[model samples]
Target chain A: MSTAVWNGAGRRIHIQEVGPRDGLQMEKAFVPTAQKIAMVNALSAAGLAKVEVTAFVSPTAIPALADAESVLRGIERRPGTVMTCLVPNVKGAQRAMGAGADELNLVMSVSETHNLCNLRMLRSQSFAGLQEVIAVAQQGQAAVNVSLSCSFGCPMEGDVPEQVVLDWSQRFIALGVQGITLCDTTGMAHPAQVHALVRAFKARWPQTPLTLHFHDTRAMALANVLAAIDAGADRFDASVGGLGGCPYAPGASGNACTEELVHALQLMGYDTGVDLAALTQVAAGLPAQIGHDIPSAIVKAGPVHQLHPAPASLEEIRSRAHERLQATANGL
Target chain B: MSTAVWNGAGRRIHIQEVGPRDGLQMEKAFVPTAQKIAMVNALSAAGLAKVEVTAFVSPTAIPALADAESVLRGIERRPGTVMTCLVPNVKGAQRAMGAGADELNLVMSVSETHNLCNLRMLRSQSFAGLQEVIAVAQQGQAAVNVSLSCSFGCPMEGDVPEQVVLDWSQRFIALGVQGITLCDTTGMAHPAQVHALVRAFKARWPQTPLTLHFHDTRAMALANVLAAIDAGADRFDASVGGLGGCPYAPGASGNACTEELVHALQLMGYDTGVDLAALTQVAAGLPAQIGHDIPSAIVKAGPVHQLHPAPASLEEIRSRAHERLQATANGL
Candidate 1:
């Protein structure tokens, strides 16, 4: 590792806000389509490089994000912000493109066990199916990004070999997919593991755009992000209010917090291009809308730069100290 | 920064638990003396390098830790674990030594405003007062560690100059104190700031043990620890279950989580000399004793090595996938 690894000074770190899609997918209360659009619109204007607006999966599968089409079409898109959405199959890809998604995000678990449990299909079936979906998505000229779940390690299966992740990434890259996201779905990725895998991925395909999605389940998300940055990664997926959690591991936090990550990067002199104040303001409104407390530290404790007023009793204390010092000096 | 900065391959990281003192100070409920003793005993047996057992300050000032002397004397002492206590003045230092504390931790804020507000004295007064307290503790043969609060940045006054921190550290080191803990009282410390400060501190006094104390108030504690390690810091102060909060900054987390820090370090191949499983177990029992939830991620999500059984529906999904694949192969 070089000094550049720890010092992000002037580096352009890409932040992809995934709250509208990944964060809301786990919510029991369905967010109104209007509210969903409003959230995405705010995030898009917050200078994020991308926003995973909504998932174009079956409404029955994830009723929480049932308004995928409405959300994708309704949100105001900024010129630099890529509006992306999860597309599970050919039909989903078509619907997502039809709804005006700039990028079609296809996902599958790297772990065979997780792939079967999550997608209800074998890994091979998923690969073949996604290949067809990619063809469909490319026909519509939408950029494609494949997100490999359990890329770090699977909760149930334990270690998903690093080769498996790279293999999936290599295959997706060969297919001309624009990007790949290595997701630590269960927050099982540690710094050492993240650095190694990221280095290997960059070594093999340095030109391919890579994004790291992390869960704060074990509170290693930020540390893992730092490690990835050290290993030449610049893009990250973060959720507003740190929303979303592993269904496999209940009570665990979801994605890395968007505001927290942006705040940190900005403080380190990284060019994150995120309006942290506006983003935190959006995150601050989440609890009221979602009807639950979020796991975001920034939403609770403002960014480090937000200074507090001195204690009101400071004057009294200062005067008392002054008096005591004078009395001692005068030999009273 | 070098690769050793990011890779803690065989480096030994020292974790000092400060939950019993720092964590409990903010709690309104008075933890029973017996329960406090039991908690300290459990932590001591959990293979921590040191545990800040309790604060020997005025019982009236912090009624929650009123039983500090009884709790300190009653806890079972482990041979390798050093028991330390916060001693604000000469009387407190004498009381701590009489109660069998292995180390007396003296504290003051680097920020003049914070020192006045917090200790109701000027920085010079606090320093001179603690020097006398140090002399008193030296007579009792107790090791001394000076903890400088708001070494990173003061919530009220904002930036505390790096020169100010180093100057205070130099003065204390000249007093022949055993160690100095740089306290990020409000979690304002960032990775860059931490790296620079720790690097400077280590450069000037490589032989004097330095401990980095951070808060997760802005969710940057773990990241700051990583940066400090990069700057040659090995010792850290963490609270069990991420206990403690800033009285000035409401809704902010207190200290870096002990189990989370140890778990991360161990994953990075650092020798933390901590029984993570035992520490997590003790942390798990905290909510019941404190009558509130703790912010420990490991206690909720378990360690990465703790494998979860595959989802119960996995077998069914596997069979379903097999049938679908077979049908597809037969072109049915």
Candidate 2:
């Protein structure tokens, strides 16, 4: 049987690293601003093209990122690295731009319940806020990416209609957002829905750069990514170590682990310019640092076909060899 | 958006538990026969409809499962549970039947290199052996399921053509095998390849039960499972705590972690009947037993939206809420 090499169009999957901002934000420990900067710098050294550095929300709102300005200034910027910040309104956008954020991410919840609970604003009010944030980012000459939260399915209002996502996408694109990230905020998406939505979105806005942010809450994140990729969407947002989830949504896991995502992409011969071994090294340290083991498969198990050292004793060697043979025989 | 409810028919996914035989066989520690039985019993208690117990191989060949009879005798079989054992040849089949295995799993490697290296036989010889096993198992009125290893791709040979998997499937099914499992032995399968193989196999033999076994070595196991499920596959093979890997296949992780599989399936609205919280309890003990952390996502992070207890003080509550609010705002 001849091997079929994955010759899919060699479009590099852009990984937007949300570790420092998305990962540390949820931690109980007050990761020092210096540690946050170090983590971001480490991510840059790890070859991540985009790193979400910090959030510019009010300190009273998020004490974890209270020193967002100092954190941003502390990062050792690498050439061609896009350092992004999450901004809620015009004030946050202005602050992010002033702190040297290369990109400003504007978010608006698609579901009214989520918008009210999350942003403390109604759907229409959040859109109004988005308009202001977009204006500020544009005036500051910084790229703005809009994330449509709960685009796939919402916990508060389940099964968000494709039409709603499409309508909001058009609005954001028309408002001059460079990219539109469709988020499965509550993990309510199936493959068919993902494929249909992505196909429809691409058909309507062919030129819009579409990014997918999926939570592994339902284990459909990677599957959804596959469907979307098949439907011609490439860029995706993943949190390293599968960190971060909606505090309000029950049973939602973090965004797809970046290592798992990278491993999947590289195996399919889709170059994402990520070093799996390096990523694993970075991830290995996370469990100890955060006081909980990370939810990543490859980091713990290592890569496939990885050979552990054979036992020195003859009996052990024979036993190990036999197990290998049985696994082979079992088609495992 | 309406709440996404699993529509029973297309949503019921079957998980084939391979922990007992595949998982324990690969471990360095010689799991006591009693422990193997207890583990199988625990797995059955956790609601697995099928559990692959032990292999009926020569003690000289696989000493780890040499106590197959003891393991089988010790297990407290639950009603409706399909207890399976791996059989290498006709001799193994006789032993399995005598030991009262509910099902006999016969394996043949599709790739000649793997067949020779692991089985010490040519592909035709392995097939001939399978025919004998099938004949014996049929005479005893025992069920036989054939797994074609390296069906998608091989570590030594690289690409495995689709026709090879199709041909093997046809041959195995014609031999009165009730099930066929495709093994991504080296974790080389891409989603497109998986979809193509499953579609072709399903088209040719729609009635034959199909199962997919994949390793996370390439990080495409779950993604491939999604593709296969989309292509009409309902049964999968998974290991508890993501234990077991093919020693012959360099760099492969263990079988897809049972916890991750169950989490994904349940979230997708496909009922596998396994209680995830119960499985997590089972998984929590695996790392200590194996001396390494199992490659399971849910085990580390717990379920999505798993809320940590809030602090008692109002000041602490306000601070935590603010942090969570900021994290959500950042789309972390």
Candidate 3:
């Protein structure tokens, strides 16, 4: 993760498909554990570098992901793919580690109001609990990623200070975690904010890998991605079919769509390792499984370069145009 | 426009709403002329500097916009707003001028195959007709903007050569037109292509104003906007509710949503001269007007910072969390 180890020019972009975890958790109707496993296996087979298969929050808290263990056990594990899970507490951390999670993604918000509302825990209590979880994760030899919710702005508190984020990031670094994800939990991150914050973070923590998780709620996620890239942040967490929105976060919508991100990056000549065509087919089947139409433009309309065939009168028009051009060429 | 004349830092962004014409043209259900005019006037009232009211194509060619003259005559033209109409031929130009259009947007395709499929004429024929139309527009004291279709790429012919676009742009410049629109007729534009093209065009002709018209066919319109801005293009053509698409262009979807563009620009601290809230309401009414759901994310998700009220149990969570924090702070 050091700048010396970092590839020159920030060309490598890693996509951690969070659809099975973050996306399915947004659905009111619980997706069957078997189907979730199938999707994880499909995503793994499709060359995704990482997949957050499920979250290990209390079932009483998020019933949609109640069968997280079952899904984790059912999926076929691939050789090169890292399987990750979100764990909110010591209990969840233990359970996720027992499920053989390659990485444990921990969470809290920089906004105290958001942290309390989202997890019903004081900021200090959440950090204390996370300390115990991190110890357990270390004992288990599992990598940990601390995801900071509302890192840019909060619904109740307006804007979260950059110092608070940088301070907490330092705390996570002290805890010997793998990396950090600055989550735009409610899609409040803007391009300028993203650029300045990401640049400062990279300059401050050049050795820590940064992942940007964006929601397309305000239609700035993709733009923010570009800004992040311009500012030297490359890793992103995208959900397939643009799945994942917070029901509690009113007017909230899904993540930066996986296919859209991939298509855009690929068009810009950035290699994502994930095949867009294969990812698109997987996205196309998501609506049926989730009982709602996805908010994906690429799924609705094929790739930007996918062409429509010419009309039936193409021959007649071409003949007429050729005749005119030929007649003009011959000076008729 | 010259860089010296542009606002400092290129902070000014122009949005030309093309919903009244391009949007309704794709709907199978014919909208009343009165309703069309009402929408146009409402858009102008919403502070949109320009609105493309309707297209004056032959009724047999495109019946959806057959009542173009009625719509043009019915609208209450605001002094600050430039009311525009699409004109494909000399006859269309005459009808548009007679109907009091402030600007006639002449159209042809840079790709010969696209021209053959769309206009059923040779490229030379279309240009010849456009020359006559331009003369008529000049006589009527109406400004003209020539929209070159498939300026990025074409479905029928694949990639349209950049030389062709630049060469055609030069021709339009020689024809005494006021401005030029590089249309992404099939959403075949990416951020890199957009940035490079807009930069090339601006460097070539710093005097003529350039407008980018993009479809969110692959969910890259806003990203393309960012690129065009980075490359020095300011004006763009957007559709309210993301309502327009080409029926002939397979996989084509709506233009960049007006509320989306305005919302993104406003968030990025750029002035778009359009009220996003007022525009969102107008866009909300478009699904009913078009007999289909609109493709706008802002219209569905609201503005980026429109915070939702906290849950009813927030008091419970606050008390419980504070109690836990106090107990832990006391080391009890």
Q: Could you say which candidate leads in DockQ?
A: 1
| Model 1 share of native interface contacts | 0.77
In candidate 3, the residue pairs with backbone N, CA or C atoms under 3 Å apart (3 or more residues apart, or in different chains) clash, namely: none
C-alpha lDDT (0 to 100) for residue A147 of candidate 3: 96
Candidate 1, clashing residue pairs? A244-A254, B244-B254
Which ten contiguous residues of candidate 2 chain A have the minimum total lDDT? A1-10
DockQ scores of all models, one per candidate:
0.71, 0.15, 0.42
What is each predicted model's overall lDDT from 0 to 1?
A: 0.90, 0.77, 0.84
Per-residue C-alpha lDDT of model 2 across residues A66-167, encoded as one tens digit per residue? 999999988898985789999988888888989899999888888766665666566666787689888878888999999899897666456678898888
TM-scores, each model vs. reference: 0.98, 0.73, 0.93
lDDT of 2: 0.77
**Docking model 3 quality class:** acceptable
| Comparison by DockQ, 2 against 3, better one | 3
Clashes of each: 2, 16, 0
Task: Report how far residue A258 has shifted in candidate 2, in Å.
Answer: 1.8
Tens-digit lDDT track of model 1 for A1-332: 12665567799999999998999998988889999989999998999999999998889999999888888888896898999999999999888888898999999999998898788999999999999999998888999999999999988889989998998888989999999999998899998889899999999999999999999998888888888998889999999999988875677778899998999888888999989999998999999899999988898888888888886788988999999999988999
Each prediction's RMSD to truth? 1.3, 7.6, 3.8
Per-residue C-alpha lDDT of model 1 across residues B101-220, encoded as one tens digit per residue: 999999999999999988989999998999999888888889999999999999988998999999999999999999999999989999988988998998899899999999988888
